[model samples]
Target: MSETQKLETQISDMRREKNARPFTLAIASGKGGTGKTTLATALAEAAGMGVTLRDCDVEEPNAHLFVQPHWSRHTEQNRPVPRIDAQRCSACGKCAELCQFNAIAVAGGRAMVFAELCHSCQGCRRICPEGAISDENMPMGSLDCGMQLKDPAAPINFISGKLAIGQVMAPPLIRAVKNVGAAEPLNILDCPPGTSCPMITAVRGSDFVILVTEPTPFGLNDLELAVETVRQLGLPFGVIINRADSGDSRVHDYCRTRGINIALEIPWKRSIAEAYSRGDSLCEKGAPAKPALPQLSATWPTTVSVPTAMLMPPICT
Candidate 1:
């Protein structure tokens, strides 16, 4: 059998197995405006109860808008930034020189630090000859927790990361958001768009990934990059084409030729767009995406024996 066919068979087998550990599903995209959030929200709703949805798009997290979860806890996220104490030492420029991010600069017989550019690496603090540099907690963002208000008793635990406006670092906040307790049977992470640091942080430990994309040139171009990223990370993943019928068939052809499984497809629909504008899940009343949610959330093995392991069930034929 072809590689793609074998992978498809394993996916089917995973759905039949009953695994105990909650599966972590990361819904990611290569670029924006691809209806990634819409599908992620709908899948969470379809998975029904016992699900935890973490919005890892700290910069533009909007999953909460659709879910409208009743917030229980809101905590500000902070990270340590190096601070230079003038009274203790000279303007040796050591801190500025060691700051690889150009966050600090010493000139005109003075030293200045740009908090926004700082990565909190603490190299400045350690390299300071006179111990003039110390650490200060800088507010990076906030982490909020709640439950779906619609069904409070069986509400999906909702955790969202919002990076402070103008904040450069999101990985820390993403980590904080994921650190929240998840007792649900399934954890769905709405990953940030693009294959950047934030996206990697969100999908770092996921069991499976759903790559959402359109079928246009832009989508196909970015999808290849995203597919490479997940493959490099050694995570089992599948593709879903949004507005499948609207664009050309390059995406389909690429998937077929490359042996990638097109897990689900959502055709062009005005209602889905309208519903999304209204902050709705677009999963109402026999939606096409509803049927695929079960397979998306199926019990998939978390670990593969090797980095070269292709998509296949270890315990199933």
Candidate 2:
């Protein structure tokens, strides 16, 4: 067998073994408007039954618009914020001093807790010498459990997290959404944009990652940042160039130089864009993009394999 064939066999076997447990695939982008959601929903549809799609983009999750799963359960998620006990007396400013985020402050012989500033680390509660610090559950967001209700036998389990209107942090809520869907054979996490904590939290535990990017200058710039991020994370990942024919060849060159595979190149199509605007899935029947999506899903492990050497090396600008 050739080197490529041998590698393909090895990866295929590895994926089969890993499928016995939950196999998570996270779809992420360095910036927004990179067709991250478009590819994510397409892949999820192509995976067919028993696949769980977790929309971890808590701030502005829109995957539901495409799948349109019938939501069956709604849950309110909460984070533990430090609540100071005035009766415990002796403020002594210990809790405030221990808080790195300045979520707690000692004023007027009392301590005030800023729920918005709290990261839910519980550091202040742990360090309070006077035992004046306690935990209060602050509402972080909501989680909705739904499925492709149209077909009960072949349901696509859909779960999404939505951050509260004023909530500044999203990693905690993203973590909550990820905690579920462990029992499914395949889980696709649609991560938030950028290389911040929220995106990191979403993609951290995935078995494989698919970074989506366009070929424009902004896309190339952020894709470089995202490539660096997944490299730092030590995760196996590949790039999918959306609108592959629209921009310059710099993105292609970057992948070539790094020995990174451009797993798939989706050329721009006006019909696909029009269908997407109407909340239609790429893999749905009569959809303009249906044909190309199956080729992606059918390739699977062979398509996603990244060279071990490529994943380890420092990315160049």
Candidate 3:
């Protein structure tokens, strides 16, 4: 049996053993430098839903810098890549011809497989009449599991997956982190920055999406992009303006014109940054944003209650 088949079988077995009832919420931004992680952690702490934090930003996960976690467990996440058996050698160039990802190349009576380009489709193996193709697992990363120690009085479960350095793909790791949290918990996924594959993987199947943005020109530009991304996904999403008072009013203006709910706003405050630098929980510091943060916890259920079509604007233009 190929490695891909074995891994798929394992995943199926695990799913059968665990019946998961999770409410996945993704925190996203259209660009980097936005406070996606900060808002995700704060909202998780505020919701008090025994939330599991998945730092889907495998490229650079920083949530742990704030929410201290106890009892971390590391587990390997891997993906399948095709392996060619030269000895079984028909070298007819069939595999290379069939591969859509350009993962296989044949030249000079030799076949080379570029594992990174492989999407693990297993088509090459199935099509190989000579049985020269097989699949193998490549280590992607390790997932760290622990509980957030925001309040010694109440702790929340947190899990993050760190992709192996130099790994290009991150969606697999994000999916792995989320799979672990799906067993029986409410989840708040701190998605990676940008509105690309990684962001889509993080937000896909989420109950709600909270897009964090500022009010500057750059912020407005990115917020529009993020909104369009979520809209394209047909997911229910709202806006949260961070550094709300510092920039132009265009963000609020855009939201008002679209009828998008301004879920919460973290004002421009030196203390917020100071507390963050000190690795202090916003709840403990009485951060001016605390009240506003918890207000989201109250608003989320109601937002979910409204029909998605009703919340969306008449025309996305």
Please tell me which predicted candidate would have the highest TM-score against the true structure. Answer: 2
Runs in model 3 lying further than 4 Å from the true structure = 1-20, 87-100, 121-123, 126-131, 149-153, 297-317
Q: How many angstroms is residue 138 displaced in model 3 relative to the true structure, after the best TM-score fit?
A: 1.5
- Candidate 1 per-residue lDDT over residues 72-114, each given as its tens digit: 9998889888777768858898888888889999887767888
The TM-score measured for candidate 3 stands at 0.82
Better of 1 and 2 by TM-score: 2
In model 2, pairs of residues that clash are none
In model 1, how large is the Cα lDDT of residue 54?
Answer: 90
Please give the lDDT score for candidate 1: 0.78
TM-scores of the candidates are 0.78, 0.85, 0.82
**All predictions: root-mean-square deviation over Cα?**
6.1, 5.6, 9.7
Instruction: Estimate candidate 1's RMSD in Å.
Output: 6.1
Question: Which residue segments of model 1 deviate by more than 4 Å?
Answer: 1-22, 87-98, 106-111, 126-132, 149-154, 295-317
Better of 1 and 3 by TM-score: 3
lDDT of 2 by residue, 191-306 (tens): 99999899999999787788999989899899999999998999888888888889899999988998777767787889878888998877767987666664453344454445
Q: What TM-score quantifies how close candidate 2 is to the native fold?
A: 0.85
Instruction: Note the Cα lDDT for every prediction shown.
Output: 0.78, 0.82, 0.77
| Candidates ranked, most accurate by lDDT first | 2, 1, 3
Comparing 2 and 3 by lDDT, which wins? 2
Best by lDDT: 2
